[model samples]
Target: MSPRPSSPTIPEGRDSDGVDFRNVVGILARRRNWVFGVPLALCALVVAYLLVAHPAYTGTAQVFVDPRDQYTPKDDPLQNSVPGDGLLLVESQLKIITSNEVLNRVIEQMNLQNDPEFNGERVGLGRLVKALIGLGKPEDRALVTLRNLRKKVTTRRIDRSFVIDILASADTAPRAAALANAVATSYLEEQAGANSAFQRRTSEAISAQLGKLRQEVKRGEEAVAAYKAANNLVGARSRMVSEQQLDEANTQLTNAKTRLADAQARVRLIETIEHGDAGLDAVPEAMQSAAIVQLRGRLADASREEAQLAQIDGPNHPALQAARAQVRDVQAAIQRELKTIARSVRNTYASERTNVQTLQANFDALKTQSQANEKLLVPLRELERKAESSRIVYESFLAKAKTAEERQGIDTTNIRLISRATTPENKSWPPAMIMLAAAIFAGLTIGIALALARDYFDRQDRGPEPDAVAEPDVPARAAAEPAPAFRPAVIAQHHAGRLSALSEDLLAAPQGHTMVLVQVQRAAWLDDVALQLARAVIANEMDVMLVDADLARHRTTSRLGFDKAPGLRDVMAGIAAINEVVQLHKPTAMRIVPVGLSAVAERDPRARQALSLAFRQLRDFDRVIVDGGEMGSTASEFGLYYLADEVVFLAQGPGGKSEDAAILVDLLKLRQVKARVVFVEPDVSVAA
Candidate 1:
């Protein structure tokens, strides 16, 4: 048995196939013309475009809508649009700034309808291309000019701010600046007009309401007057006449009652004096009389004289009688005065009572007239209140109209210009640097893809792989697994130079089979030689198989890691089929048929016929290499030698000069099997 050679160790970051980075670098180098030419061509095209294209200048103007006041309710038109959202308000204003109403004014002011840059009247390469493609005008000439101008003008708001930016493009810097300024001015004027109109509408509305209120005030005042006249109500100093008279009558009634009470009391006093048993001394009139006073003095003297006489004489005395008569006379006189005083008092009381009664009757009549007038005063007071309210409302509306008119004249500025457009110093169209960079990037991507595609086709055009790879007859499960015990091409290619002559010495198929027999003869490199020879034959564009039919030793099978696998012995003993036993190596594209269970050839009488039948099944391959056991005296020791048309003897082993190999060689000569001796140096690498 021989030992297999050690495999080369793979470097880090590189596979057994090749280095990935080197493969990429190599592909670029091989297709260098494409890689460089494409980018240069694209750069040239960009340069040509930048040179021939029109150079347009851009001018920018900024207009600020004072967010504090622009969104206020003072202007109904602007306020009603995009309410409560500040950001949306600014965005909507940007749209309004670019609207047709504003842009049309700019067009008229700037005479853009006749400008070549905006009017579509100028001829250019783009226009010529469009014309060639039948892109004729679809509207009137002035309409086309307006559409073109609109395309050249754009409006946008600054982020998170109320400032709007207006941009215009033109063939000349001054024209561009003029167009931008015109557009800005037009937008500001439109906003101002909208605000003015809103103010005017407000004033008109106030005036209309004022007129209605004035009519209401007049009607309310008229209603109060009509109510007063209809009920016969009269007033002096804003007071009813009947009410005044009733007040005066009430005062008089109060005085009359007092007077009547005093008079009745006086009358009662007189009657009480007359009916009572009291004397005229209690009477006031009697006390004030001079006649009673004089008679009282005379009666007092007579009573004194009579008392003196009555004590001295009897009832017939003349002096006593005379004194009694005088007393009687005085008493009667006093009685008559008392009666007169009573009559005078009674007359005075009666006069006062009559006057009080008359005044009470007059007061009662005044009260009834005042009560009727009071009932009519209710509606009259309500009408007065309404008239006062209507007058106040009319004055308020009138004041509001005046205030709105004043505001409309003063607050006409809705937008202010933050920045005016200036003549640009450089062209904006056909950006040279950016275009060149983009062109270079695109060219590199396309060039790399095309190069890779061409390289893939070039590899595909080469011849197909050997039969071992073309028709892999492996099991379904083993399709994912790597080839069994297959050595890399690194080892095969390393040994290819030493085995080149040996590959030529391998005999072609004589008539029916391309089977070549090899006798190891104690060669330590038996497995290595057989593998290298098979790989070399495959590289020569031939399908080849290496068979380890040396059943006694099974060196190739043991070293190739398939010693117990089904092989020639299994095929010859009816244990396995030839297709099932053949092993295909992926890395070297070498097929090897291993020897298994050699005892079958010795014990089974039909083993020879089975072996011949197996060899016949393998006739489709271009070449078959059989590893016979060490050389021996009898041809029976090398069972596959009889089937082979050629035999190779390894000269490095003792069996090459032994008597047994000599006898076998002569027998091979007699059978006319072409035989040769190959001297192979022993391999230095240890088998894994």
Candidate 2:
């Protein structure tokens, strides 16, 4: 049995495959010089760039926010105090600063519009000189000139600050400073103009409103006066007094008529009683006097009773009738008394009538006086109405006049600057230093990446040593010890011994030599049948020399473990003795000869010579097995046909076409080689 191959031991303090941090570090450390050098070169390049770049002179000017001129307090009635930020006003001011109005003013003041520096046309002093010397075109000079112009002017705002810095660069420092100052002055002037315009508009509006209000006051006064005059309304107090007087007079007249009617009624009542028909005037003497007096007394008593009865009862009552009977009797006496008194009363009535007429005349005079006073009140009422209307007008106008006066005097001092712009001495662009630093950083990063990539692509093997004597399809396993080296001549000796044994088995048959089986590998098809035939002949105890004749792509000899042997080529070339080339294995009783070194077999004529000599020597053995190279090669067919006793054509099953095999047989027949062809199918067990 062949000795098993040994296994390699892995070192501790390393990965399972023997890789370690030290190995990785070694790779990077080897490349450290490049990594450091690359970054340093980048930094040097940055420095060189900075040195070659144009030096710009930036001139700046400072301007105060000018609280009174730029920012004005908002007049919002709902607000009590001014807003501190006034963002809208600040934004408007910023617009004015950058506006064409300010820019145009700056351009005019500095003679910038016509100056080549600000003109859209390009021009340069260097190009102009070159043109004068006939070295440059005028248009090219103009472009250079514009480029220089663009470098001179710059403007930007400070970070979130109210300051806007205007910068100008020029060949001379003074011009740059002058340009910046001119821009700032122009901006200031623009601000002043804007404020003046706004104030003028406000003043004009207020003056117009004041004039209209004054006219309105005059018209309102006239209207109020007209209303009062039309209505004839005096003062409220005078109207009330007139109404009270009329009411008093009406009451007095009503009372006087009531009294006159009652007095007249009393007079008529007395007259009616006096003229009644019953007469008691003649019965009133002493006895007549006694009787008449008594009658008179009774009559007086009856009259009193009638007066009481009238108060207590209606005239139709029975009690009232008794009273009336007495009253009739008393009325007869009263009629005598009244008739006597009536004459005197009629005379008195005539005198009273005159008095009544006199009283009525007095009342008529009082009425006339009251009418005259009411008539006199009308003009007074008109005058009072005029006075009231004039007073209303005066009051309303007085309020307006007071408001206007207050507005005129109100102080505008609350408008003040909240923030001031400061002058900036340095420019805010082309941050070269930071850019250089970033470039250096990027170079270092690239260097590291390149190092890692280089390590990945190189395919050299690394780690622990391999264990097996032969590297097989599977990984190597541990064995007790290694196998011994093989000899070259042992293969031929084993073939000679196997041929002697086969000669013994064939003694009964005409004492002739046994049939030799010579198998060859073919190209266009794999030769599993050849391998199986070799195994079967060996099982029969016949001598078999398995000659691997595949000279191109030497696969068969390598598969048989005779890759290191020298055989057919040595004998063909006469370089080595025959016994030294063939190799034998005693344990399997198998002799095998590989086609000699790979170089000899590639030359077609030499390969054919080698095959012919090797086949001629095979007659010494009982039976020889030849692995001819693929049928595709002419050399394998020529050499094998001349040498073999009987050729066994081996083919792979499920192999492509049988044309090569059939053609080989026909070719052998044409040559009249003494050989019988036998087709062998590939054995399934051996193939698997």
Candidate 3:
């Protein structure tokens, strides 16, 4: 027969034979309806909708915004749209195409106010219900139609390109195509109208400036004419009268000074000749005289005749005397002519000096008059410059105004339609394959979550399964001494089933120390039950310890064959350590701490604190079963009661009226402990 038996404990999972996959499969199989049901219903609805719903048609049109075509007619800069803004122009035109101004044009042209899809008008019961609830304020019919048109019409620019696509959706194909084309036409018309209006405004702006500029030019010219008259600045050929007179005076004065200088030089030369410092011929005045030349010629002829006669005849010769007399006569004539030429030069020099003084006076007067006229001309010249500037500006404005007027009739928007919309053959929404796939995915996700959630909650509702752990046999104790008032064989054999249940409840947790207050008067009974509970806990693979806390008699110490062992009391009194006093029972592998021989457990004031320290240290063991003796009058001795996880009140008969035990139970509320009480009645036949 097997020595080990089964005891009740909590189990972790299913039986060892079952795998995790099967366990999960069983849990989900129970909730198959949720896992498969939702997707089927959603798919059925989608299929029915695809069959019954109206088949929608989408029409598409393409517009090309030709930025390269500036279309500027004149020099007016505003004639062309912002062509330099390439990508920016495309984006701005997108907004303009969607604006109310363009959409209203389309609505009026196509008469979309009467179209059912665009009008968004509700009739019958739905309108009445909305009116009663005030869902939205009543709006103009045109506004509602415009809003619906805006919603149905879609516009997008092709990727990094100059083409824009306009899409419109409707119930029928023809109406959809017409709607798309109308929107494109409306946008182009809006752009053209914008250009025409801008040209007109520009013409008006330039005209507004023309009159003011003209007035400015007129005022400038008049001021220049008035200034010229006031300052006496009239002139000929762009020069003042004083300026011409000053030029003539300066010329005459310069010529007079030159003639005077020449006359003075000639007069000085004649005086030098008269003083014999120079010859008469050496002076130009003398050399230019006719009388001096003729006299010198006659002297030269007579001297030549005398030289020939002196060579031919003696000193008394007639021709030589005649030549001497002729030479003296010619010298007298030459001297007379030289004096006449000198007088003529002095007179000429005097006349030239007088002429120079008169001309100098005239030139000075003309210079003063000319300088005064030049000062007056400064303001007149400034006024003339202002008049010229005003005329130039007026002409510029006049040119701009003419250009603006000419361009008013011409439209220069470069946007044009490239492709017209065609009737679509297929609907855009409610794709059957995609909806079916989505429905399946959603159903699987929801079903799996619900199945797992239900399984988890069911497991929580049922309690945990009990573990099949081995139970220790309460074998008969071999004793050499006679037994006390408590019989171990009787209680161990008959009360084990009942005591095992109590021990399981008290020691549910397999870790830490549990001080169980056993209110039994008999010391032998404490030893038997503490040993029984400890041995039972050991079968579950735990370390169990026992402490004999009965102070008056150390009977449990002796029964466990540790009569001479130093124990908890000696450790409390500082006589022996807990390790030296503790004894192990070899048969059950149970450990015990018996009361020592030299210490008193009843009267020590520090006994409770020292014992609490001892219990706190014993938490290293899995279960420490404390054999607290019977309840006494003082709570100071029963301090372990506060630390106990439970209280097993063993009385031997019907539970006795022990007020000490009741008071101890009441005081346990200080620690807020929910103590488990197990009342035991001794079986008389088993005891006998």
Q: Of models 2 and 3, which has the larger TM-score?
A: 3
What order do you get sorting by lDDT, best first? 3, 1, 2
Span of ten consecutive residues with least summed lDDT in model 1: 467-476
Candidate 1: clashing pairs of residues: 633-660
Candidate 2 ranges beyond 4 A from true positions = 1-53, 66-81, 120-173, 208-215, 235-432, 450-688
Q: Against the hidden reference, what TM-scores do the models get?
A: 0.47, 0.34, 0.52
C-alpha lDDT of all candidate models, in order: 0.68, 0.51, 0.70
Query: Which tens-of-lDDT digit does each residue in 264-370 have in candidate 3?
Result: 98887777766886677787766777887788899899888888888999888876887889998998888878777777778889988998988998998888888
For model 1, how does the per-residue alpha-carbon lDDT over 225-322 read when each residue is reduced to its tens digit?
Answer: 78878888878527888888888888987887787787677667777866788775676656777877877787788888788888998778887788
Error of 1 at 247 (Å): 17
- lDDT by residue for model 2 over 1-688, one digit each (tens)? 1221221122233211111233345456656766677788888888877765544455676543423322223344434333665445545555565556766676667666556545544355565677789987435543443344445655565555545566667534566677667766776666556655655556555555665566655765566556545645333544534455556666666666665565555456555544666332422222233445566678777778778888889889888789888768665665565454445445555555665566566666656766765676665566556656656655655554554444443433223222233333444434687868887898788776776566444312122222222211122232222212111212222222323333333322221122333332232113333333455456666666667665554444665567778865555555665557778755456777776763443335555555555555664554555665544443343344455544444433322323334445565555554443343322111110
Off by over 4 Å in 3: 1-30, 48-52, 66-85, 121-139, 235-382, 454-688
Better of 1 and 3 by TM-score: 3
lDDT of 2 at 124: 54
